[model samples]
Target: MPDNRERDRKDHYLPRGFLKGFIDPANKDLAKPLWHFDLETTAWSRESPGSIGWERGMYDYHPGTNVLEHPDEVFERFEREFPLVREYLLRRNFKGWVKQHKHFLLEFAQMMRARSPLFLQQQTAQNENTRIMTVTSVGPGNQVGVDTTVPYPPPARFIRNRTITAMREEIKKGPDWMENFHWCLRYTRSVADPFVTGTQPIVVEGRYPNSNDAPVLEDALNDHNTIIWFPLCWQACLVGAVDRFDEGTAEAPPSLISHVRGMFRRPSAGYVISPIKIESF
Candidate 1:
């Protein structure tokens, strides 16, 4: 029988770099085992009626509880309520609409940012043993892509399109946009697969501690204390462990494909070391 000391040694025998960089010195007991999740950008599907028309106005009226007013009726109501405002909206195009609804638009964006982390916390509470670290993109791929056959709902559709485009542009210019932008992008996609195992997170390669995308990696490390970063292409998987504030580093673990190949080669193999829990992302 394996002794307690032997068991301890086997369990704690992670790569040296992984331990020094990721594991919190204060919590050397490995209180929460680190898990990684990947993010992917997907085009919007137009086939489903529920998926279409995600404008602010869509939530204002329910098909069951209220009659869906025609666009002209809605516009007439808006004009009646604020006659002077109608002229401004007509003259400035989308700029006037943005000015009028700036607060609501910002709030919508903020809500999108908050949803994922809250969901993740809820999931974690349900199962404390599994730590889910989500990875998403904040670069160019954050723009909306659609694959729909139905015609958009006129003015509402235009408003939604303009609002999203403006929001994306604003996010691109902001300093800490990546953190919030990624979540917002995911909310827009509204796909079932949370982990996005098939898609790879964007990797910005350069200098060790001072790369352009370093903050993004650092932020993830700080949040979860460890990350399993699977880059796209044929790049090796990176196991990042966080040691302290902005003091995390990564090590290349054996590729999953290679590990599987070795397993197939030796079916009678008693044991195989893996960098992460192989069951899920």
Candidate 2:
């Protein structure tokens, strides 16, 4: 008989299996039609010539070359004028003293790029049958289910899902797939504020397969399945957990949660993380 333990060890690192959970039929609501949302921003800058303005139409910020003169007013205007951008900035604590710092605006732009459909759509377009969906909102404070004094704003919450077929094709390109996926995740982390973590607005209902229960790479490839789900903000936690596991340090990392037997589970259904680190760099 095949040793299920050995199979799990090998399948744990297979990206295909991980991707399948996102597009499973059971997750259709979370995988709502990609065309429902309109991401177009207003060109708020065009009307205000020679003044630092926000292009509400195109969702671009015009610095007017001297944005430092009135940092507070500039940011305040952003908050009052551009609701979406304001929500994202507030989550990162971009106000008062923080507004004076260099790289504030640049960081805002980077955050928008990471949260926007621009990059995902570009990547998905490369594949013939792939599509991308991005949902953005400012979360309600009470809605997060975590006790905190701070109010969660809309536009700060972003969920991105891309057709898994694109990811599979990239995986077929040999080891490059690993690099590409890791790079994408890291880039996202770098651009986002540390406080900005993913939220599970849509609950996926299904049985999450354990690492040992994952399908083999060959089977996963032939299955032609896809997965779509929110990207959780457990990268740091994951790294910490894996590090402790690898070094055999004292107990499991505190970040490790929802453990069932050999696999570590996420709050979202059908997503599992193996104890060992699956990708590097």
Candidate 3:
């Protein structure tokens, strides 16, 4: 085994710079706190960006004594360019995306899907839920025969091994949205109903014909009706849908924010993040 000593222990799924967008505008303090509703405790608390959203050694895979494959650096690089994307988003300058900016934004979206606790939970659950069966029969000539069927869900060790090396491959291929959909940036002007996010920052739902249903993850992917919402900060969100990709600034319709807020209460995530204390939720 490779030496695992002296490694970076804090694996922050939600990087601080990305979460910084949700800081309340009224509080201009450098050490501003974010309000979070703990799903596990069923209580609210305040925390800094660096203190929350991390698990110990989630991504510390070692193949050599001194070498480390850090998504850490790539995450920081993506966040460094985030402000520019946010600037263009808030300004509704959708055309401002040069090749590099577009690349960063799309890849960040893919990372948001891959580099979260929710992703791990989903992949692990899919594997563990896999079922196998065995059948036994008696031969006419007093010989016994048996058959076994193994399903496609990979073993847990295989999953972990792939996760360590797959980040770059996934980044290179990018997300389905990058290839197929146009994008939208949504800005909510109301302070009372600012956008809220979660540990699993990327949330998805179906629309129109299937609005009442949540989209299935795979197997005939419901991408055509799926709508995704990613909270960029307290004021803005990035949205993508099959039908429309235009950006806009508007107050979320009366029932909309409440519905979206409910969607962020993912079972896998321990908490929900907001810019300010929200008693109503």
Candidate 4:
């Protein structure tokens, strides 16, 4: 066998910029490692039956699940029951969402307090719940596209209609909504996939060592409603958001197609060899 000194060297095992170097070389192919998920949402699409609006007022009530609604006589007896009535009304709405998707409802309930206060008190209090609901659809298509058929609006395009519309309206009158309004999901997939490969926990050391630098990294990837399997071979895979493409800088918001193409490039594996003036034995 040829002498294995080169292979056994510390530099060989702990290559300089190992993760970054590896990904840099094989980025072309590795970038294309399937980064989308197709969500299946036919069962939990419609409004739940136990909905309690003015017309629909708690019909089919279960023991532990249902909130108690006092009768007209009872309401009149206790003049202070209006507060309870309001609480019950709001609780019913919150619990109704839980009846549909229990898992997410739990997560949303836990994070309910940490949300920012909005204009609509009743709705804003449950905005985290709304986010959980909204993200359910957006989460799937996060990296690739939130593939769905709810018929009202597609989640990927929904952001444009919802968030962008608000921003544009604010921008027309020259408001500082950009700070308040942010693109919810940027350079990250909310859904989890199992088959496809992706990167994780990537830490980039900015070129300017002492500058206020933030190196972005791939956060999540999904495929077929499962977290994609990112083969450990892929390294230093990062995600960045740019406002414009071909702007001769990295600050432009890379479009979906460009971002996808950037992730899935060829020569996505192996090493780079620089010509050195070492004398071979």
> CA shift at 98, candidate 2, in angstroms?
44
Show where candidate 4 strays beyond 4 Å.
Answer: 1-183, 186-257, 260-281
How does model 1 fare in lDDT? 0.27
Regions of candidate 1 where Cα sits further than 4 Å from its true position: 1-155, 174-197, 200-222, 225-232, 237-251, 255-281
For candidate 3, lDDT tens digit of each residue in 188-272? 6776788888878877776443332322344223467777777777776667666654334344564777667777764533789
Q: Per-candidate TM vs. native?
A: 0.20, 0.16, 0.73, 0.14
List ranges where model 3 is wrong by over 4 Å.
1-5, 30-32, 62-69, 91-103, 124-159, 207-220, 245-251, 266-269
Q: Quickly count the clashes in candidate 2.
A: 25
Expressed as tens digits, the lDDT of each residue in 165-262 for candidate 1 is 33333333422333332111110011111111111122222234323222234554344333222211121222223332231222223353444223
**Per-residue lDDT for 113 in model 1?**
26
Evaluate all candidate structures by whole-model CA lDDT and list the values in order: 0.27, 0.24, 0.66, 0.22
Top model number, TM-score: 3
**lDDT order of candidates, top first:** 3, 1, 2, 4
lDDT of 4 by residue, 120-220 (tens): 12222232233312333334457433334342432432332233223223223321211221111112211111111211211112233211112112221
Q: Which ranking of candidates, highest TM-score first?
A: 3, 1, 2, 4
* Shift in Å, residue 118, candidate 3: 1.7
